[model samples]
Target chain A: MTEQETIGFFKCLADKSRLAILKSLMEEDMYVERLAERLGITSATVSFHLKKLEEAGAVTSRKDQYYTMYSINKPLFGVRIIDILGEKTSESEAQKEREKAYREKVIASFFEYGRLKSIPTQRKKERIVLEEIAKAFQAGREYTEREVNIIIADYHDDFCTIRRDMISEGIMTRERSIYRKAERNGGDPEPAGR
Target chain B: MKNRIEEFENYMRSSAEEKKQKIAEMVRDGRADEARAVRAGLNMYEVMTALFGAALKKTGEGEEGFSREFHILKDNVTGNWKRNLEAAEKHGDAEKVMIEESKLETVEEIVRKFDSLF
Candidate 1:
């Protein structure tokens, strides 16, 4: 984890409500309503906490038909504090700043009011756009083609092209009609073969 | 078995014809978004009606019941998105804040149009 992420992870865990939520998930995966019921909190509150936990990389959720099922990120929990402290920061601040600026420039050029104006023809720029679009997919969740299309269509009109490009570029992978965001370091691993 | 096959074929032919007519009607009514959704088989009400015609009739509210449900769902989603937006702002996560803001704006626009209609 980066310094910012380490801080975010700790800050997210420092809440009683979130800790309770994690405790509940230790038993089994539960949807928002089930979590709410178990904790005696409102569904909205449960959803809010889930969102925070998800951002903190402490919890992961998957689409289960009509509902989203949340579970603890067990691997994340296994990391020792000593390991985190021993890790060297990966990138120089200046390099990170430059990359951030380039990403923003590309996004501003291609996107208009949250919608992509057109797919970029250049391979480099297209890869950046694809990565931005990939953020819509939850890590460790598999989606049907229709579900994938619907999410991609929100960004651009030609979802087919974008979807195909995502697979071709290795940003996502598909097997037996199920789509998953490609695993990266510090990301969720692929589940054992179905 | 042949008779059943013929009956199924006829039913499917008529169903396709009916859907074409419905799409035309949607376009005529200036419901392009809904028409597009119908074309894509993503219109919530149409999908629900197709899946649960008998249950809808049993409810007796039919379309109105679905409309009320849609409104409630939209409002609940709007509430959630607003909270998410607030949280994103608090954390200063620019990308998430932008995504939430855009989503909230789209939902608000849809709600405004829905309110105007009803």
Candidate 2:
């Protein structure tokens, strides 16, 4: 695991409920209801923890008839702390931190109480603003220009400038006045309603 | 048609206490099954109301009026479920007891889920 993944893994495992779930799975692969009964908690709580454990790679699940059985990922548990700490990072951690700091600085400067005060003039900052605005529109869903404006208008009166900037920066795509949030990597577009 | 719409409006506006009183009267009259059914129906409304409040809060449109009403309905509904569970047990009806227990459990889960959102 990378440093971030390792952090996420440890953060997920730090929870008492999740540790209890892992302990339960250590004994046997159990379904949600059974785990809930064993722990004396509700099934919903068990499912919630299971989702986090699954994301952390601490647990794996498989379908068994009508129930999904969860088991501890023994290999993940076997991984050493020293190995994770000693691993080489593919990217510079400092550079990533600097970029995040810069993004936050830009967002903090331009936004006030969830509304944009003014459009950023600098191309880089403008791109950041446009990307943030694009989050309002659902990915893969097509929207009319009017619909886009109505959504954007909630943020600022100058929706036209922000909307135009989004298209120019390729943060969004427009076809026949219909707009869709653009995929960042020019990858295959997501199927609608996914 | 207008009278029916007005009746529904009045029903919707009626407090949970009024409905509970009616259900209590039905029980006092020894109409246990009918009372149980009416209570179940009222509990369904409570569940729906809580779910609606959760949806509103989730969508960032948690109006204060709705929040107040939601709390009122939740309080009444929780009490109603507990009473149902007790009644089922007293009547020695295993199936009804299970149903009431499940409903209570489910509602508690939903309430916890929504409470965490804030």
Candidate 3:
């Protein structure tokens, strides 16, 4: 059985009525009337719980002498529990797969639903970006106004602030809203010379 | 603006993995301190997971809001650890689970069933 079916089984087992039924059934199989009496629940309620447990692969009912006997479904239990609990020697090893599909939703709301959120500062290692943006300025090739904004914005959400920092760090200079390296070197010229 | 949750979770998992390996090596080499540290890590994982659960609003019976799907995985893994170490104690593997059983209450009891490991 799949995880949902397994989960369904546990959820079925979660109920008071079903648990009372299982605790009763652990001794021996019994008729529906006996179950209702032992559980002190109504016969209809007992039957209802039985059906759910059976659906959960927790129990099985079989017609007997003038009454149906309800007992723990060891075969199904072995299949589901052992797979998760990793038990071998289970009887249902070669049986057909029980495809129990529920609406399996993976609700990963990544805080990116409606607005453009900045990647948080905790994830930012400024040293790495400082080095990367420093490379954005090339030999005597100053960046235009928009280029500086884009470069700073790439590594940080607060571009204006980071731009100020870069200026303070002597990495770049701004004039007439454009930016350039404070002084471009032959600047460790690219080895491939491209 | 630090994503404390993600960092905390990753740090917890890798930290647990390291402890697990350390204990296994201890088992091989008969180093008892390694086993003790491993037990501590498992207990820490359990307590942190419970803290996460406590932060969430109770939505239904045992259904927690503000919790992630990874909680289930963590639950199963810790359950497996308890089961294994309990069996280990049964067979004279170590006293790690016993030490943890006294110090932590992270493993919530199964409904209607009560035990230290539960």
Task: Output DockQ, candidate 2.
Answer: 0.02
Model 1 residue runs over 4 Å out of place are A90-194, B1-118
Q: What C-alpha lDDT do the candidate models reach, one value each?
A: 0.70, 0.70, 0.55
Tens-digit lDDT track of model 1 for A1-194: 87767887998887666888999999999998999898885564567678889989999999999999999999999999999999776569647856766876898789755678899999999998888888878888989999999999889889999999999999999999999988861153221110
Instruction: List TM-score per model, in order.
Output: 0.36, 0.45, 0.29
- TM-score (0 to 1) of chain B for each candidate: 0.43, 0.47, 0.42
Ordering by TM-score: 2, 1, 3
Task: Please list the residue runs of candidate 3 whose C-alpha ends up more than 4 Å from where it truly belongs after superposition.
Answer: A1-132, A184-194, B1-44, B47-118
lDDT of 1 at A188: 31
Q: How does candidate 2 fare on TM-score?
A: 0.45
Please state the error at residue A22 of candidate 3 in Å: 57
Prediction 2 global C-alpha lDDT: 0.70
Give fnat for candidates 1, 2 and onward, in order: 0.00, 0.00, 0.00
In order, the interface RMSDs are: 16.4, 19.7, 22.4
Model 2 agreement with the true structure over B1-118: per-residue lDDT tens digits:
3343244334433634565787788667543433554465456546655555464565444444554555566777679778867965665444455457656754665455445433
lDDT of 2 by residue, A93-149 (tens): 857856866886898688755678798878899887777777777878899989999
Better of 1 and 2 by TM-score: 2
DockQ of each: 0.02, 0.02, 0.02
Best by TM-score: 2
